[model samples]
Target chain A: MIEFKNVTKTFGKTTALDHICLSIPKGKIIGILGPNGSGKSTLLKMVVGLNKANSGSLSIDGKNPSQETRNSISYLPEIDYLYSWMTIQQAADFVKSFYRDWDEAKYKELLSFLELKPSMVIKKISKGMRAKAKLLLSFSRNADLILLDEPLSGIDILTRDRIIETIIKDYRAGDQTILITTHEIREIEGILDEVFFIRNGKVALNGDVETLREEHGASLIEIMKEVYSNENSQW
Target chain B: MKIANGSMLSTLYKKDIMSMKLENIIMLVGILLGHLYFAYKASTGWHPGTIPFTSSTIFSIVLFVILLGTFSSIRREWNNNTIYLIMSLPVGGKTIFLSKLLTILTQLVVFGGLSVLLGILSSLHFLGSDLLVEGLGFISKYQLIQELLKFVTLLFIGVIQIIFVAFFSSIVGSLFKRFSGFITFAIFVISNVIIGRIYTEMLKLFMHLHIESTRQSISSEFFLAQVGLMLVISIIFFFLTSAVYDKKVEL
Candidate 1:
């Protein structure tokens, strides 16, 4: 489980993440939904030790996300972070050398699923293909926690569906936790067990998806639209 | 299967070397060939120079290649975001830094050794058929061996200094969000200028004091000892950089 306690992160004078306190348990798919500049990415980065909160503590399984904590967590940044000059095989080998739980067979299977040639340099691939390759590398690691920021932002509908299905099929349950941040909530609503709607720098709304739907007679997307629309109506 | 915890440093070092491309090898070879050609031309009367100067120039060229290659390796990794992957491993930042240092050191030694071997071959050719007799006449075999050892030691010291500068620059580059390369270069230049000024001032003071005996006492062994101390200081600075990197907030 990952917990953020009174976490407040600021950049210059603007607050990127307000005093946020939340506990995410193990074995669930959580979605972080927000529009641009909503601090969704900052929150995720904080959990992975990429960003330090200005005045609070974040812990993964009761431990701060130090180098030791990072060993158990796999993170996919929102950009193309792979080395451009490396062939897929070389990248895989490089990653495998560092990770103890690297599943070579699973990595190979993911490559075939994504239709990526092992010998091809990453810079030569299209954007969508590169995204798939990144996903393959992150997923093949048998980490206890996976944090993916904006995983489905640039892909088409068909490719997005494929990625979603791949995540669901390959994800190791009970022993692993997945936190994904994306704008496309409806596409992943079926797999998301919990949802957090962030506005400005705070959690505007958060609850179990099924419970919220049953109580409010509305889907997660409808609630988000209503809340955001009403907030914008005053302007 | 997992890589054993104890051997992780060696594993990472080996992988770093394997990741080098054919292009990098070709560039190293090109530099070596260029230096060798210059040495041959100077030694064979195509250019004018005393034997010691020619040898020293050849040695300096090799040293320059080693420094360039080491710095370029780190720069390539930084440009490609390979450092992110490297830093995310279970290994400590110190281990990763040390592995890279060792890798660069090994490459420098190998390249430097090859250049020395080429220099010896060229010298033999230039000295003609009485190669053994001429070498014996110039210096005793034991003294020649000692000089060769000193040369190797000096080359190693120079390589260590370059590594220190390169690693320091990389840390500076990674610290900021914008114009990192420019900022790192500026820091390097300013620091070097300050050090140079201090060194010059000390030399002037020594000359003014008429310390002839002090100047005469400085030998190759003394120089090597000073360089060894500098290498230790470099390692400490590298450790500080790694600590900051491990805790830095990446955007």
Candidate 2:
């Protein structure tokens, strides 16, 4: 489980996360729902150790995020972080060489399912293909926690479906934790078991999807619009 | 199944080299052609002085390549957004720092050695059968070999010292995502000036600190003190780099 106890992160004078307190349990897919600049990415990065909070504490599995923690966390950053010079094969081999939990057969299977060749150059690939490759690399690892930041921003609708399907196929049932951040609530609402609605760096609402849906009498998309569309949401 | 740090380093280094493989290939081909041309010229009685690449040119090229490699390797991560990928790995800041340093060091040693080989081959072409038999006073074969060894050693140290400077500068730049170019340049220039002066002043201080009597010559002590200062400073810069990476660098 990843726990954040009054965690606050800031850049210069701009606060990214303000006194965030959360507990993300293992073996569930949690969708972090927020509009742009709502601190979705910051929260995900903090858990993955990409960004650190200025105050308070964050712990993954009852320990602070460290280099060793990365062994069990497979992170897919929001931006395109793959080197342009590497082939699809080389990128896989490179990431595989770093993690002890990398599964080679799974990687090959994902590559085939994604319709990507090992020899395809990353720089020359289309945007959707790149997404597929990134997803494949992220999913190939047998990590306990998977943090995906904006996994479907630039991809087409077809690729989006493929990506979501691949995630469902790859994620271990009730044995792994996946934290995904995306503003596309409608596209992924069906799969998210839990949801976190962040407004002005605060977790305004967080609960199981069924509980939230039953309590609010609205879908995830309507809830996101209502929570974020408020001018007072910018706390 | 667990990839060790050694394997990770090698893979990273290989990735670095693979990115530069095309440029290295072009450079190697050009150098080979130049070597063959000079060899042919030497066979036809062309003098070494007339050749375009003297010892100085060869030395400059090796150093230039090292400088290019150092800057390019560090900046490429940011320019390509690969820093995210590199930092996300299940490795410590020290491992990343060491891999980058090792990549630059490997290029220096390998290319520096190649430059020496080319220099010798060119010299052999000009000297022919009389390559080792020359006994011309101070230019004797033994004297020449000693001087060459000393020169290579000094050059190696110089390269390493500058690498530490560049490595530390790069880490300092990594601390800021915006205006990092200006920051890196400012740090490099400012620190270079400050450190250069400090080294000179410290050498004199160390010299005076070690010598209490009039008979203890200053020349050898000065040389040793200078080398010692460079090494100590290099290590300090290396540690500073690792510290900044661990404690300060955001991503």
Candidate 3:
């Protein structure tokens, strides 16, 4: 449901995405795997219309990303984006007012599943809980596309497992498309239908996990090491 | 299940206002204490002249708060990374801009209205109603109402113009990755200068065209025409700034 044609984004002298082109199909769980500064987050941000591509075109579902497209794209950025003064419930209500796809039942279910109290203030909550809160808000919406940028980064292993479980439990295969970016491959490798290994703002390798394993005769993590080692570029 | 556009706008307006609740309360308390202290002083046989001076100072403080709030409201989003949430919303840039503008205008009206009322009441209490009425006796009540309306219109237009300038400068500043604060301050100063010059020229043009030989001072028609000109400029800036915000500003 997302297409990037020769998209290149540069911040000052450093290029974030370099003339990269890729197509992400609808209703599939896709993992965009890369190390830090590998343009994974940049690619996701471009899809969500937060970062504009400098040269090439990017579109979702045959339409350009804009305010209207944002309705269908639920994004969980790698930052604390919620207001500090708001409780999780207040933030949910504020977000719910803007989206028609908001599922109250799903929200409450995720709240309990995530072990997040509705009355917990965002500022007072721990980082892992805040990440869970962000995930809750995102998953609450029945958006056609969900972009999770570094959701597992800096999160504890337990919280990360819970987050991964949250994704797997609520995710409806063939109904919602999820594009997640992270270097933490082993944890998410099992859930991903397809994986794209990005390096230095370019796609180094991508394919279906099963097909890739069959062809390479190795696990995704071993394959990741092979890919990075074969490339001369510094990580 | 989606809300209509009007409701969305109202929801955004409410959120903006809610965000400022703490600042509003602090301002309210400050104004209240100022009034009470002055009231206490007035009752203790203090000089009458200090009442008007102190009341005007309070009004100035309110104006200062409005101007500062106009800039900080937008900055707060960036400081807290909440702009990510705001930009991700389904609403366009115009809605975001207008909601903020509406919130500031609402505060201006509410706080400004209170200040004017209290100022007049305190003036009356200190100076007595007879003297105040005598001062106002020179003009008919209709003329007085007309003048009051004109003043309010001018004040509103002026404040709106400043808000647009501040918004434009802030947006322009965001275009750069470094030294954005200096850039924003510089743009603000330059924009105010250019706008102030244009405003002065426009006022002069209107006054010259509308002035009559029989008139000793500037006519009310000139003020109305100037207010109209300012309003049009503010609207143009509003649209331009909103367009930039929509297509250009990157989060």
Candidate 4:
């Protein structure tokens, strides 16, 4: 489980996460649905301890994210993480060596399923291949919590379906809680047990997807659109 | 003492070495060639009296390599967005900073040793022709080693200072998301100029105050003091870098 208590992050003039608070539980696929600059990535980065909060506290399993927390959490940033000089194999091996829970068999399966060549350099890879590479890295580790920050961005529809399927397949294995952020909502809603709509550095809507759908009579995407449109000062 | 994960540090160190393999090779090879050329020229009567490249050549090359390595190791990570992967690793700021600092330091040692070795061989080459300290008595091996050691050790301290300066600049650049390249340039150039001026002025004041009775030279204690000053400043800058690194924004 993860908790953010009045966490705040700021840039020069803009507050990325302004006194925001969030609690994310385990063993479910949670979609942090928001448009760009909605503190989606900032929230995830805080959970990984990549970004320090300006004020307040953030902890997972009652402990702040640190070197030990890194062992339990896996992150996939939307940006290209593979070193430009590395071959796909080198990058995979480098990542795989760090985790004790790394499953080589699963990694091999994902490599084959993802259709990524070992000899391919990361900088030379296509956009879709790069996406798959990021996905492969994130899914290979049997971490307790996996944070995928817009893993579905900048991809074709088919690739998106493949990514969604890969995530769904991995989530079904259990004991793995994934928190992903994305603006593209229609594809991820069916898979999300819960959704957190963040806008202007605050959580606008936070609840179970099914209950919200039943109560509001609208899909997550529709609600997301509504959340952003009227999210002026409060959410 | 704060514990550091050794294996993770090695992984980070290895990645930097792999990324910097070509530059490392070039620098290593350059040292050999520079020494051989300097030695070969001095052996013959082609150059009348003065050695073409002395300590200044070594200093120039060493400083250039430090700058290039620092840029590739630190600034390149920020530019390439690989800092995310680096920062997210199961390690603390101390681990990241020390691993990188050690990697560059180790490279400096290797290259620094090569420079020293080359200087020694050039001395011997000149000695073989009886051109070294020509007007003075034959220079003993012990005296030669001491001289080279003094020069190299002083230069080593200088190289460390330059490395830390570039590192601090890289840390500053990471604070900004946009135009980080510009910030890095300004930090590296401007900070170096300001620090260099201050260092020279301080050194001049010290040398002026402590002039030996002969007026020919100051004591070895002066060089020791200078080395001590340089090291203290380098360590302070390193800690500053690590402190910023610990709470750095993942921009």
Show the colliding residue pairs in model 3.
none
> For residues A58-160, could you state the per-residue lDDT of candidate 3 as single tens digits?
9888889987798888999999999988999989998988999999999999999999999999999999999999999999989889999988878999999
Model 3: residues >4 Å from true position, as ranges? A230-235, B1-3, B207-221
Isolated chain A: TM-score per model?
Answer: 0.95, 0.96, 0.96, 0.95
Candidate 3 docks at the CAPRI level of medium
User: Candidate 4 at A107: error in angstroms?
Assistant: 1.4
- Candidate 2's residue-wise lDDT over B65-91, tens digit each? 768667777888877888888877877
Sort all candidates by lDDT, best to worst: 3, 2, 4, 1
Off by over 4 Å in 1: A230-235, B1-7, B18-23, B32-45, B48-62, B65-72, B127-151, B189-228
lDDT of 1 at B179: 87
> Which number leads on TM-score?
3
Select the stronger candidate by DockQ from 1 and 2.
2
Off by over 4 Å in 2: A232-235, B33-48, B52-55, B126-132, B135-151, B206-225
For candidate 1, write residues A1-235 as lDDT tens digits: 8898989998878898899877888998998888877788988888767678888889887888787777777888778788777788877876776778888888988888878889988899888888888888888888888888899988888778878987888777777889999877878888988988888788888989899899889888888887688565221
Which candidate tops DockQ? 3
Query: Could you give candidate 3's per-residue lDDT for residues B1-251 as a string of tens digits?
Result: 44577777887888899899998998888888888899899889889768888899998999899888988898888989999998888888788888999999898888877887788889998889997778778556435666667777787788899898888888878888798878988998998888889877876776577664233333666776678778888988888888888889887
Error of 2 at A13 (Å): 4.1
What DockQ do you compute for every candidate structure? 0.49, 0.70, 0.73, 0.45
- lDDT minimum window of 10 residues, candidate 4 chain A: A226-235
TM-scores for all candidates: the values are 0.84, 0.89, 0.95, 0.83
Selected candidate, larger lDDT, 1 vs 3? 3
Cand. 3 TM to true fold: 0.95
Considering only N, C-alpha and C atoms within 3 Å, which residue pairs clash in candidate 1? none
